[model samples]
Target: MEIQYLGHSAFKIKINNTLLITDPFLSDDPDLGIKFPKIEARIVTVSHNHHDHNGVAAVSGNPFIIRTPGEYEVSGINIFGYATFHDEKEGKERGRNTIYLIEGEKMNVCHLGDLGHVLENELVEMLGEVDVLLIPVGGTYTLDAVKATEVVRQIEPKIVIPMHYFHPKFKFKLNPVENFVKEMGVGVPEKTDKLKLSKDKLPQETKLVIMEAS
Candidate 1:
């Protein structure tokens, strides 16, 4: 499988013939100055109603959209969306967010969309094993570097990819990825445009991968 970062929390994941996209924030906006390259996907997963994470209309192709917490099977991929919150106040402040576990190509990829708090033991058990964890490290509306590192320890994924952090083009106020990198105390792998991963290539110890926004 291959994963391509599309800025912010958006990612394009390819497993065999099927392609999946998370948080389709493709349209150019004043807050985020980058315009995402056009790409078609078979599946699109939206975590919440926020414009940055729920721009499903911007994605091309008649994609299968997953917006709520549930179990779904699209093509050959298995997806489980666990109900989470966008704030620590149990959605009282930011509403509900879905944490998606996508199972395909003998690998499980977990995308924590705008997660605002650390996972409880029950939710951790429900998540099972996560090979790749895509988590938000930007503060303001989501988990900051400190909280993001805590979440990383909770899930214990083989590969960690931080998202939703402040970028040079991002106008929003948020923590930079460096804060998370320092907190994690892990070496930063050279940033790549796309990450080519396989089940065999997974590291035994958690490895941090930085992907350049495509």
Candidate 2:
């Protein structure tokens, strides 16, 4: 399977002949100036109902949307959404968020949608071993660099991808990606437009993978 970042928290994951997109941003957002490309997918998973994460209309082909926590299987892809919060206040401040565990072939990928706090022991145990972890590194509305690094340390994913941070088209004043790299004690990350990997090819230890938004 391959994963491609499409700006903000949105990502396109391709498994076999099926395509899955996560967190499509609405066009009404002022920070959005780039065009939402003509994209189609068989499935879509939303972390929350925020304007930046629930633009189902923007995705064509009438894909199945997964937002709540449960077990779902489609096109040989297994999805498990674990309930979480977008703020330390436990959704009182910013509502609930969903942590998606997408299993394809023998690989498991976890997407922490706008997670606002560090993981507890129980949540860490629930996550198990993650081959790839897509996490939020921006502050204010989600986990900042420090908390994101804490989550990374707990989960110990083979591949880590940062999301929901400051970009050229993003108007939010969240911290830069470099801060997350510094927090992780890793060298400057290499940027790529897309990534393809398999179970046998995973790194022996955790590593950060920076993906450029399309």
lDDT of each: 0.91, 0.89
Per residue, candidate 2 scores C-alpha lDDT tens digits across 54-132 of 8888899989999899999988999999999999998999999999999996888999999998888998898788999
In model 2, where do residues sit more than 4 Å from their true spots? none
**Backbone collision count in every prediction?**
0, 0
Q: Write the per-residue lDDT of candidate 1 for residues 107-151, one digit (tens) a residue.
A: 999999999999999999999889999999989999999999999
Q: What TM-score does structure 1 among the candidates reach? A: 0.97
Cα miss at 26, model 2 (Å)? 2.9
Weakest 10 consecutive residues, lDDT, candidate 2? 27-36
